[model samples]
Target: MSTPVRSSPLALTVLALLHYRPLHPYGVQRLIKEWGKEQVVNVGQRASLYRTIDRLSAAGLIAVRQTERGSQYPERTVYELTAAGRDTARAWVREMLAVPKREFPEFPAALSNLLLLPREEMVEVLGERAEALDRELAGLDASLRAEGERGLPRVTMLEAEYLRAVTAAEAAWVRSVVDDLRTGRLTWTEEALRAFGDAGT
Candidate 1:
């Protein structure tokens, strides 16, 4: 059979967890939440988690390691990754880290239509966004500090580090743009504005 697509966040997460040890679905759920992997992996619903498990099993990426029965609860099937699954997970993680996908986030969408607003209004809105980003960066800083104090390695929290850096960069760029708008450094001339309006019509 052709290679199965191993692109789902949930699927990759399951593979990574199983690489440590075989786990039942409930165990997987708990571990993901406990490790904060749920922030990056979408394991919101139990049904969806089960479905992902089923798909991986069907694709020969994972297999049933055992079934557990408890007097207080129903039987749960535990799963472990096949050799192919382990290799796929490593490849998937490598590609994801190396490749930047074109993500259509709302900020860029609004930025593209910024000319619809007056320059002053755009400056005001972008100023607000910069303030929000500042708050977010502060929170991230606090979280990183706490994690570091708790002995979490810098490598383990790299995603948070990347986010903090990206937010700082964006906030700096927005501040520069706002400054340009306020100082007439990036103002539009009447003739050019009229030409643009005419072109729109």
Candidate 2:
């Protein structure tokens, strides 16, 4: 069998961010924070972000410029994407659009690993995630509307609207899942476990 292609979402996100312009590690971090404002991932786990940049540079998708030392006792490595990197970013975006959405891994993993936690705790976690998604969707919708009213270039406007739609869909899905959990429509019982096992095999 052919090996499955393993790629990091962080790397993909980094490439998409750089498609607009070249950026250093600091710049990427700033852009990610800006994009993820009012969403998850602001809990000071930026190591994954930096590691993705390093991995992309090692893969030749991005190149590190000369290191610049700050006034403090540290230095920073600036990076810029190559032409191939830009193409890769565009291609990844298109591929993502072409794929169908399915249940993500993390949610089930959380449920399965929550053996000791009460069911109410799991429901609360889902509620929190749903709320976060709603905020992100609102932000995306506002941004899209603002950009659309500005009459920007068609390509740019299209991308903004597309992202807004994607975010809205995710938000809707999250809300539905959370509602199911809260209303007893869904449960992580043995039957559910069996169903998952059968579906997997």
Clashes of each: 0, 0
Which runs of model 1 end up more than 4 angstroms from their true locations?
Answer: 1-3, 44-48, 71-74, 189-201
Minimal lDDT window, size 10, model 2: 35-44
For each candidate, the alpha-carbon lDDT, in order, equals: 0.87, 0.68
Error of 1 at 34 (Å): 2.7
Once fitted onto the true fold, the runs of candidate 2 whose alpha carbons sit more than 4 angstroms away are: 1-5, 35-44, 101-201
Predicted candidate 2 versus true structure: per-residue lDDT over 85-190, tens digit per residue: 7777777767767986575767667766765667688678767887886887687777767656777565755655666676677768867866876788976687
Instruction: List clashing residue pairs in candidate 2.
Output: none
- TM-score of each model, in listed order: 0.80, 0.54
The digit string of per-residue lDDT tens for model 1 on 1-201 reads 634765777888899999999999999999998776765778889999998988888888899989999999899899999998999899888988899877898999998888899887998999999999999899889878988989987888887788889999999999999999899898767799789889999
